[model samples]
Target: MEYLSNWAKNIVYYILFVKLISHLIPSGNMSKYIKLFTGVILIIVVMEPILSLPNMEQKIKSNILNMENIIAHKDFQSQSKTYSKVNDQLAINLYKKQVEEHIRKLVRGEDVEVSSINIKINEEEGKNFGEVVSIDMKVRKKNSSNDLSIEKIKIGADSTAYNITAEDIIIVKNIKIALRGFYNISPDNMNISVSQ
Candidate 1:
């Protein structure tokens, strides 16, 4: 093969060069060092073909690609984990808002208006995840008048006094029942406050 011919030529040239150098130098300690150096070079030249085998380059390239892939895979996994956590938190917040709106709708027909609502949901990873944990709401009577008005008194025994506190308690009870029926929540987990 061409490779074999080239290698043989190289060895022949190296040997002739060494011979010429030895002739120029008298046999001494310097000649001994020169010969030792040329011997090492000759060994390398002889083993060049075996050292540069075709598969060696492919094996090295494959190992480099494997290392790169492992590093990239690790980076991707970490990024995905971070994205997943952010997405989960966003979902929980959105769900809580939706639940609060639903609660307001459920009590819309009642004589009370919802002032504020705070709903808590289970955040753990399980079957109960996203389930409503508790609800806190502030409501006020719908037709309540903020201004005080003076009116003519009808003190004859024919006028009946209306207990406003008793009516407010009834409205609160109705709201509790509606929420409990729809969400399967216990009374203990609900805090419904009526504001004047």
Candidate 2:
């Protein structure tokens, strides 16, 4: 091929030039150093074709861009996963608060004051995720004196007396039943306490 012939001619011309230079210079330490420098130049000339191969620059640039894109994509995926976890946690917290408020309302309907309510739900991802796991509630009966009713005079022996403990048990049972029916939670998972 014409290209191969030109390359061979170039090599021949470089060798002739080096030989002429060496002949003009006397054999000495300086001559060896010059030969070494010329040898390095000869290597560069010999590798010129391969080094200057077509699309080499484009290939290098493309490889760099591909690496950059891969890194960027990995970073984006990591960020998205982090954001998703945070969002899921936020949603879970909001749901817990809403369920607590609903429980408070249900307890209030029984003429009880809710001191605290904690509803635990499944946070893991699965079919049972977000299901209520347990509930802990602390409540107290509302003050009856606020009713402003007149005291009745006892004309005879009382047939029945009010028991606060019994009332509290009834309130707790009612709360458990309400929660079980509405939220499908088991009474075993509920810890309800009525405090004086």
Candidate 3:
């Protein structure tokens, strides 16, 4: 009786193994082809949007009037009184957003067209503001069909908050003009110093 029971157990185990293996295998040619098609579709669906993101050919147009303050002045610590005079919360936010938008636009395009900008700060005021929160830069532009000369212009950028200070202004504007067909950005030329 024990031998008979053992034989029955072995048969049952073999039947289960066969059932499991059959279930794991693809049932028909149609099912296998369907899986291949689904995999291809999934790959295309996932890659399309990522590949279609805005390209670098997009132009980043920066309106000098809109970004005059933020782009003109450098961000740094400033005395309280001086900070109040130059710091425009609304302008700051607006320019900041515009900067980001402009970058996006440029990434989608090729070159950035800068018009003009100006900045001024009262060093005597905002004493409590500590170091300057921003510095001033002056920008100018001329209307023409040809590419602008960025090498002839100057640019100054300083981030006192991050301990980055730039005193020498370079002619990046000319280089930007040379790369007219490429993605380029030339803000302005400026440096931090005592107001005369």
Residue pairs that clash (backbone atoms under 3 angstroms), model 1: none
Q: How do these models rank on TM-score, best leading?
A: 2, 1, 3
Q: Global CA lDDT of candidate 2, please? A: 0.85
The digit string of per-residue lDDT tens for model 1 on 1-196 reads 8878988998998889888888988888797798898898888888888877766688789999999999999999999999999999999999888888888888887867899888989999999998888998999867756564434333345567433455566777899899999999998899887765
- RMSD of candidate 2 to the true fold? 9.2
Quote each prediction's TM-score: 0.61, 0.65, 0.18
Which 10 successive residues of model 2 have the least lDDT summed? 148-157
Q: Provide the overall lDDT of each model, using Cα atoms, as 2-decimal numbers.
A: 0.83, 0.85, 0.40
Identify the leading candidate in terms of lDDT.
Answer: 2
Error at 59, model 1, angstroms: 6.9
* lDDT comparing candidate 1 with the true structure: 0.83
lDDT of 3: 0.40
Error of 2 at 181 (Å): 0.7
Higher-lDDT candidate among 1 and 2?
2
Q: Give the winner by TM-score: 1 or 2.
A: 2
